[model samples]
Target: MSINTNQFPADGNISGLPDVTELEKLANELFSLLPNEMPKANFSPDLADHPRLEKSLNLVHDRLPSLFSKGEGFNLNNPQTSLPDPHFPVNKTPQSGFGVSPPAVRPGNELSLNRPVSPNSITTNTDYPGLDHKQPSVAGSGISPSAAHQGNAVNLEDPQTSFPDPNVGSSVGLGHVPHSVAGSGISPSVIQNGPGYAEAFPFSPDTPFEPDFNKLWSSINTFKSTPQIPEIPGTGGAQYYFLQGAGFKGNDPFGINQNPTSQLSGKTFSHIQNGAGHAPFDVNLIKKDFPILQERVNGRPLIWLDNAATTQKPKSVIDRITYFYEHENSNIHRAAHELAARATDAYESARSKVQVFLNAGSVNEIIFVRGATEAINLVAKTWGEQNLNAGDEIIVSNLEHHANIVPWQQLAAKKGLKLRVIPVDDDGQILLDEYAKLLNPKTKLVSFTQVSNALGTVTPAKQIVEMAHQAGAKVLVDGAQSVSHLRSDVRALNCDWFVFSGHKVFGPTGIGVLYGKEDLLNETQPWQGGGNMIQDVTFEHTKFHDAPNRFEAGTGNIADAVGLGAAIDYVNKIGIDVIHQYEHYLLVYATNLMKDIPGLRLIGTAPDKASVLSFVFEGYKTEEVGAALNNEGIAVRSGHHCAQPILRRFGVETTVRPSLAFYNTCSDVDILVETLYRLRGAHR
Candidate 1:
């Protein structure tokens, strides 16, 4: 039959059999690539017999006879013609045997990328490794089908798995995916790293904040692989730089960093009448409050310089302890009466104040102990027992006090672990390069003092913490000397633990604080066992409470704790920052003044030091120097100073140490230097 011009879709007028013949020829060429047989064999190699092809061919044939009779020519192969079944997959007319089309995949339900899927299979949400949820949905507009496929196939909780972004969601896992596509998500903008998002579990949307033991362990392992790097001393004469604009009014311009003066509860500076409350502390008023400072020794006024051992408490600290005992004495946890309630409140309040003083994140992190010695023992027994093993080593400096050195030795002996010593230089400062060489996978802990009590050398604690972290070791700072000398912020230092003595800060004796990171503390077992520390106790077994309380076994020293809190309050009122600056000036001044004295040889000449002067006269024995100073009422310590290794390194049995507090005047230094000069003259 001949086809005429009028029978066509709107775009064109299909006129004749020539157009149909041309279309049929192209279709035949394409079909020939398939197998000879239909559906059962290969009418369409890519798909089975599609339903639309058969139906569309039937409709076209049925209309052909009528259309031809009307002379609206039957052009079956017109490309522009609207066939009855647009869904058909076949390209040729009904003349061909095949006519059906497979159903097109639904738009929203497309099998993305190269992923093959069964038509009857149910769709499920996809998984991505270490990728956050709330990502832009793969089905969302503009997300490619290929990205959806890869996101769909991603495996969660698999250490071997890696996802780039997963935000675009359509990635096929046949090969390594691009970092861009892998990281894509639905609401991808929401998946960012910062303080706000850091609070949530970094990778998981389903179980945010659930501890990822695998990642945690991986981080730990990574830390172990890297050796500790010794911190390079920055290009500055001083370890710390004080900004000039940080309220540099000419207060204490002659400031030698001295110990802070005692602050009376009700007193203010007399000179600044309008700014009466602005005075930090009163030196003259505080002198009367310290009873031992006034006591006579060898017919001369007592000049107490035994700060390294412990300081003489001011009347304020004593009065606070007495008031607590006389007025509100009771057991903290067990009491139900009014006195008990008041006592508990006071004790807990003291703990809160201690938390603030140390700048610790929480009160639960601060454990009340007998002193710094006990605190170190607690960490050794509790954390060391659980975490350290036979191959593990703990690094302690050669300049350690016996309290810091002995407990770790005991722990290492008990556990069959190795003990490593970080050697110090001739000037009593730790040799950082040597310390770095000692850190390795087996180095499980670092316990060091911030200041050398014997030599008055200040150690670089911040640098130590950073190096220990790199070596996969936890660091504990013994701040017995520093806590009272400087303003400390634990977060700024980023150490795992910090310990200090209450007595060193003019607080009551038998009290100290141990600050541990919450996670580390939670993991450690309590070293002691008693009533308040247990959650549930039985003859068979017991589960201890979490953190500081768990470490504290029996009833704690309540009155001393309160007194310590009061002592911290006193330091705050005096401003430790101001005190620190004054002490630095004093330390430099004293160092320079004492260096010029005849026949005097100073020990422990570290560039960085606190306000401690240790020296000996060439013509006199250590005892003779001590006696000479004592005769003039100048109190000082002359011995190994509980640091035998350091003194032995210098080939000295003892050194006369005059440790200064804030109350000591420049005249006092003159008296000691002048008296020494006189003593040398007498000997000559």
Candidate 2:
């Protein structure tokens, strides 16, 4: 069944689709122009070119009279804009609507997300390695309860269904008008003749009624900053402020706090530590941070269950990347100009972020590569080529990704070296006894993934590293899967090298990280030599920069590295511990539902695992189940997931995988299970 999410739910609120984060942000800015009592002006239709926004705004503009009737304290003078019924408590999360209006501002409240946060203060230290750089510091702020403000918000049943509804004509102030309005679909003569249409607009087909306010902005007094509600986490163009404590200082007239950091303050947006000290962050609000969550597929709202393959980017991250190109776009270490300096600082700042994020010993230890794949290949080509001689053995777990296996295999094949395997028991966990047997004197490197992407298994990485150290072998922990879900402590793991991709953890593609021990990196020679990597070039010989710069070769993915830094900033604000906890809940919720389904066999049943669910249906092919789910708008990866060995070990060629994230809700899982149950009933 194709889910029509726009319908009102029978229960408390329509919940579980993670769309409209960006929409709320755009609406927030647009709402900043309206008065608390009256929408002095309709937003010029040209505010954004987004078709969904265009249709939604157009519909809302036409339905203003209906809003006045439905809302409390309703009238043109005191136009209280809220999406849900006005009687609902302010603290309750509004049953997951994507309306544009900020919650209603009760008379004399503090500014919400309008406070200006300094760039340097964007801090939050989470359990995720290196992200927890500092705690959110607030000098003067006050906390308030959550509010249900859907003012200016349009509740479209299917936002994708209408760019400009065929039944509706273009309103005034929109830059472009339909060439043939009468022929477009609906004629103005028919509209004027329609029961209430004449009274609604009171204008002929040619002369459109103009709005009250001409410009996009309204009176400065129009904005009533309500401190009770949390700011929408991160927005591309929108600024967010969370003020809390008690008495309104009234220090700044515009409600803009001078001393604010992007570091989450007050209730910490929607996700906060409750009185019981539990991270009960609302997933609905978190979903708003990511704009892409609103994407629709096959005319249905997208349920992004393919998180293991790649996570979605938040507005903060996207904005940061845009800010870089728009302002500080230049190659680093090449010029003495302003842009060059800005670019250098941004590029190096990203490295420091990686250092703080990974808790690497020093900034020099972090090297930017294309991704974890290249990072591994860098290790094989550099240290493997330099240190290892013929007959040296390499140990890899059966739970390894192809990236970990192929590099060593190629190295071993070229050098005539021996390759050893560490077997895994059922449930896809690495066996310590088998691993111990393989770790002999000749075992030069023990490489493995901390978390299996294919099965969602979290290996005992610290133990693996310790054992490898005992055998006098160098250990490399593949953190591609683990970094996003678990706390990473490279020093604590005591591994010689740690590699992960930025894209896997909410950063952009084409950029990854290689954290090498300072000494180990300095000792290794660069395989790819270029301008920046070279200290100086002579006719006879050339010297190279040490460690990171040596391996980085030429101009690296500097912009994306800066983007990775922004991603770290975003994750830091949310706090990884909070994210991990919520994801664990989502995982458990999804797992229980899957287990109850008849004829479903779950792969990778390890007790210590991340948020990946791999299962095969008895009567259904993996691809078939995946297709059925897609028809209803859920996304799941169905294949070997690039870990053929692990799947073959589990007695299956492939499986259906739906991975969870913090943005996912119980409602999403409910819909998923409902579809699967329907499928099973039909099969029976």
Candidate 3:
């Protein structure tokens, strides 16, 4: 008789072979029991017919010869006689009239049904019975044989084999199967492996077979969600931790936590205070601090006129560096060792010293760099890169040293920025009107030197800084020359940034200070990446540290920094006002004496000048003048002074430069002037 595809009796009886879904569910349950590493069959169950099922079983037997023997065949046409009872124990012997042998089973071991069976052939649970007794019944629900077989098919060649689902009208692969069985609320693998299966399978009347997709997606979304990052407090703009207690509303004008006098750590400024109050500065007492003054050059007592090049270190500064290396020698921060703690305290203390010296509001505003060159380059690469766009203008002065000039030039060249220069008058002073003309909406940054290194011109620094601010431009004052001679009050100047080298201020070399406004430093990104500068680092991303730490990447010159602190202490003790007055008196005395010589021409004669004295003697090369001065125990620089543009502007390749300092006396100036006069006569 032809099979009826859709006829059912009132008792829920169906006549022919079970449909695809029931067979697939049974096959999935069976396959899930196997270990994941077991090789899976690749055959499709939809193609399984009585004839093909027999052929597939034969193929499994052929491939795994030791597992299945040839004699264990069964006939699907008479399953009632050949199959064992559905409810009775499977270990019981079969009754007579059976045409098939029982499925092979090893004692105390679960059955391995690695081959597929035709749906019609499996009429009862016991028909293929070596499944663990503890396992859940695949057919336990009121599902009749016909219902269990409906819509399900088993691929005999492979349990993982995929087949088209007639109910869904599409193919679903084994890998795509839902992790938990539909309606059962149990994992597919758990259902097939043993004990818990009986309770997990056979859906109750209240539970439907449909999967709850909404709940599944909700769990996935929770797993993939990102955590919210906490905002750092006190920064006026974006949320970031303020370094050195800056960026918060406070009564202190400079934003420092402690008073400037308190930060001095009990160091006395009495001498400086007395001198500023018109007490005469003891030149002998001041000269006692510089040990290098005692050295003889070419058998003559040394007269140092190279202060503009680099100042000699004071005894206090040298002692401070030696003490650091001897007692507090260790890398700063992130260590539990005693030396590290001391080193870190000393380094940060030095930073506070710089902050106080510059009259900067916070210690975070000060970044320790190698020298003035690196400080300018850092700002150029970090702030310049972020702010400068094509056609933007950067203003520099004709009085700028190469440290202040070259970095902007390179940045302007790379970023297509316009570099505008404020011209200087014949006296080497920056023309205020010309500088005002350079100020415009296009000016992003105005970088100029407070005191010209090549010449003695002292620009109107506070006025220039105010103009730049009015024009909506940030200003950087190169304080390399002026910081030693004049008091640097960054708050009063209102410049966005100021830079100076420690070596120029009677401190150690390889150390400098970059003082920026707290808000500006917070806005600028770090130009380098390495240890200490970063808070966290990964192959994919890096989070940087705040302000000073962000810019100071690796191990800094710790000993030198402490020495710079000592130098600041020295300057404060002696007083910058006293130094300025005494140096001015010496400059006038030297100028008058040198001008009396007929062949000498002073190169830079600005009235408001500091310590620099640039000149050219008639019929004598600049280098020859320097050598003659050296023979008389006077040391002067003879070069472009790294201000080539300014030197070339004056129509000269180089000049004989004798820059003075407070340590230089009237006697030193007299000897230098007399030596220049003798050299001029010899040339004539």
Model 1 RMSD vs true structure: 31.9
Candidate 3, overall lDDT?
Answer: 0.64
TM-score of each: 0.60, 0.65, 0.60
The runs of at least 3 residues in candidate 1 whose Cα sits more than 4 Å from the true structure, single-residue gaps closed, are 1-277, 280-282
| Alpha-carbon lDDT, every model | 0.61, 0.65, 0.64
Candidate 3, residue 638: how far the Cα is off, in Å = 0.5
Select the stronger candidate by TM-score from 1 and 2: 2
Which stretch of 10 consecutive residues in model 1 shows the poorest summed lDDT? 186-195
lDDT of 1 by residue, 1-684 (tens): 111223344433223334334554655554443344423333344332443334334444452332222222212233211112221212223333222122211122122222222112243334322333333332211122344454542221110122332112223232221112121110111111101211222234343122332222221111011121122234143432221112213433333233222211112121111122333233443455576788988898887776777878865577667656765788877867656765776687778888988889998999999999899988888788888888889998988888999999898899998888988887778899999999998888999989888888889889988999899999999999888787778888898989999999988899999999888898898887887899997889998888878988888998899888778766665567655544554455566557767788788887777778888788889888888889989888888888888888888878898887765545566567678878878888
Measured on C-alpha atoms, candidate 1 has an lDDT of: 0.61
For lDDT, the strongest prediction is 2
TM-score of 3: 0.60
Q: How high a TM-score does candidate 1 get?
A: 0.60
Clashes of each: 48, 23, 20
Ranking by lDDT: 2, 3, 1
- The candidate with the higher TM-score, 1 or 3, is 1
lDDT of 2 by residue, 115-191 (tens): 22221233332211122222121110000011102111111111111112111212222222212122122222222
